[model samples]
Target: LDNNKFVETRFGKQLKPSSKSTTYDDVAENYDGQYRFAPIQEAQVSRAMIKRYFETMYDRAISDVVIVGAGSAGLTCAYHLASTRPDLKITIIEANVAPGGGAWLGGQLMTPMVIRKPADRFLQEICVPYEDEGAYVVVKHAALFTSTLLSRVLAMPNVVMMNATAVEDLIIHEDHAGQQRVAGVVTNWTLVALNHDTQSCMDPNTITCPVVVSATGHDGPMGAFSAKRLVSAGLLKELGNMRGLDMNRSEPAIVNNTREVAPGLIMAGMELSEHDGKNRMGPTFGGMIGSGIKAAHEALRVLDS
Candidate 1:
């Protein structure tokens, strides 16, 4: 209670005032009252968000590439595709509220992510810091890599991410060559899709794209969704399903098998593992990264041809 001293709050912690006298009002003004943003009504906020999001959806109704699942492989594929061809419109549909998928955590919910040597080139390309461990590299926090990659991909003008949007089915059609192939995706709100058992029947919408990248993971709640749907649709004979974990074999197989499973439908990431009955690589992300890059190249090739 000294006459010359005044208590101030710094993030809920009390701090002794300096020689210069500071009043409660001064601290309050410096913190809470410093924001000069325009007052916005709740309705206006809703309108703004809806307007922007719907406009984006409408504009990207017909995209060059529609990547299902915004996991590591999908995001990386989008990043490379968008970076390489800014003219190409890319739409990434993610079922979860947040993107990044399992890349946000390493094996068994650990923080550090393991990336083998050659795949570390992608880390260097993205300028993400990592620790060298002989043949492998370690990202201090998995989130660092996922967030950095996500932010960079989303920053591209032609790239759009629709999280909380679930792709229910693939649209199959006959091409001019009389070949039946996946031509688009049927989508619905993730919440609606999740609550389908209790909710009334709601028709899903469709978005057509020349190329579709199925980067959904393996044996997850919604993993390998596109791949499984393709099998059900008769486009693919069957998904061999995923084999047990075997990093050495799985890692190489995943990258090697990243290719077009059906016309216009390219499988990447863990989806490739399940589609080809390959082994699971666990937390090692080298295969995922390599698969994404290869998928992007394949997509570019398809588009160019």
Candidate 2:
């Protein structure tokens, strides 16, 4: 061995020195003896975590369609879009950590979800078992129904399911033709508002999508948020309810009225009632599912055009 060359020994074994130098002092500073592997391993893990986090953020930021509220309507719309248009990126943003808004708890915790005959085929496709009880098909277990739909939607590769996120505002922009269109949404963590932990209103992060679906159900934030923006921009008239004498006409009215209210914005489920003044048919899963399918079709048409 040359006298100028220094070899490092670890646990009675000769270890190869770093490529930079064969001196003990140089290798000691560069490598931590037996713990030399720790730094490299930590670095790899850190890089992986950062890559995963940012990749998800990037995907969400560039989603093609963003549906607020992951209820029956939202999930159905997502599932339909994912099945038909696998190439398009879809994201479902739900305020609650658990998916299936209203479907899980129904009217009360004890109440099971009831879907009419119209939604039977959809229920069967998702493998939700229901018993026909005269006027309605009664779901034996609300949780089971909710889980089945949620699981199916989550299984889609192009569908991103985001829980615990709430849309605070809608992103509106003017197209080349000078038409006002809803471009995306501003969202924040639901816990921030639920806990009231902030001293002032926190600004939310924005997600850009060509199409935005307001499946936020009755009293959803998206409808009111978009309404304010559209009305102010002169794209929409003052939001008002259409006075209908017969409340019984709500079911068909709701299903038929599910459509795009503005450029690049579609309303589904109970949200349709807000736009068209359709009577609120309480807890009718069939109408909600039909509305969602209609909304999904409208969104596809808008995208295609």
Candidate 3:
């Protein structure tokens, strides 16, 4: 009688309620006895996450291709490059603790990410779930989309991801033709850069590569940094007025013409707009992925020649 009234089974065997109502204390005691609960310490989780990334950073000190930002474009570039050129080592440096850039938290973490119908192929290739909604295709989940992309790139044997790292400066050299070419980059922990610590300026490490893809999004930190260096070296003339150029109309050009702005330095994604003074395409994923593909192909061409 007690077994029938006091217990329930998983196989749809619901025992009748006992004449005595179960009190809050009795339920709590039963739960406590049935399950042992131990919360994970926050410190332990933080250490494990940090340890995993630092190990990758320490192992791959140099790479053939160094992508400055691990956003959609950077990740896509790595994936395509690895698929096409498995022999070449690719390293992606991201300032944030986590990868995926704006994609991880889509539109302030509230809105779903939308891609043009033209970019459907990229989603399909990556096996991301998406549905057509008239003019654009919306990803099923922004988090899933970003994570899936990240997972694919990270799974590649040639790709090494270094997070919580910031690219502070570029190492440019004058080629035989007397054109200043980017050769490497100076980097430091993101915390050091963000804190404005003087040590960041003095104690930084360098990664040398023949080709550097500046996928630094719209702000284009790498492009701006390179432009200043090129101008100071008298290799690049000062930019003229860009007020007449309509950015909205130049999106197509931006996507198609993401090429090498400086010797050994290629601009991809929104960095194209910064380097070329083109219009910004707000929240557009197709252009970003296309820019990455174009940059990867261009880099391979340059390497071949």
- The candidate scoring highest on lDDT is 1
Candidate 3's residue-wise lDDT over 144-227, tens digit each?
778888887877767888888888788888767876778877888888766665544457888988898878765433334444
lDDT of each: 0.88, 0.76, 0.74
Best by TM-score: 1
**Each prediction's number of clashing residue pairs:** 0, 0, 1
Residue-by-residue lDDT tens digits, candidate 2, 9-28:
21112334657755666566
Candidate 2 displacement at residue 43 in angstroms: 11
Task: Quote the lDDT for 264 in model 3.
Answer: 85
Q: Which of 1 and 2 is the better model by lDDT?
A: 1
lDDT by residue (1-305, candidate 1, tens digit) is 46335443211123355667866667668668663446778999899899999999899889999999889999889989988888999999999999998999988989999999799999998889999999999999999999999988987778899989999889999868978988889999998888889967888989999899999898678888987887888877988889998998998899988998898999999988778899998999999899999999999988888
**By lDDT: ranked, best first:** 1, 2, 3
User: Could you estimate the TM-score for every candidate?
Assistant: 0.87, 0.76, 0.75
Error of 3 at 106 (Å): 4.4
- TM-score, candidate number 1: 0.87
Better of 1 and 3 by lDDT: 1
Task: List clashing residue pairs in candidate 3.
Answer: 247-279
Model 2, 173: alpha-carbon shift in Å?
0.9
Runs of candidate 1 with Cα error greater than 4 angstroms are: 1-36, 176-178
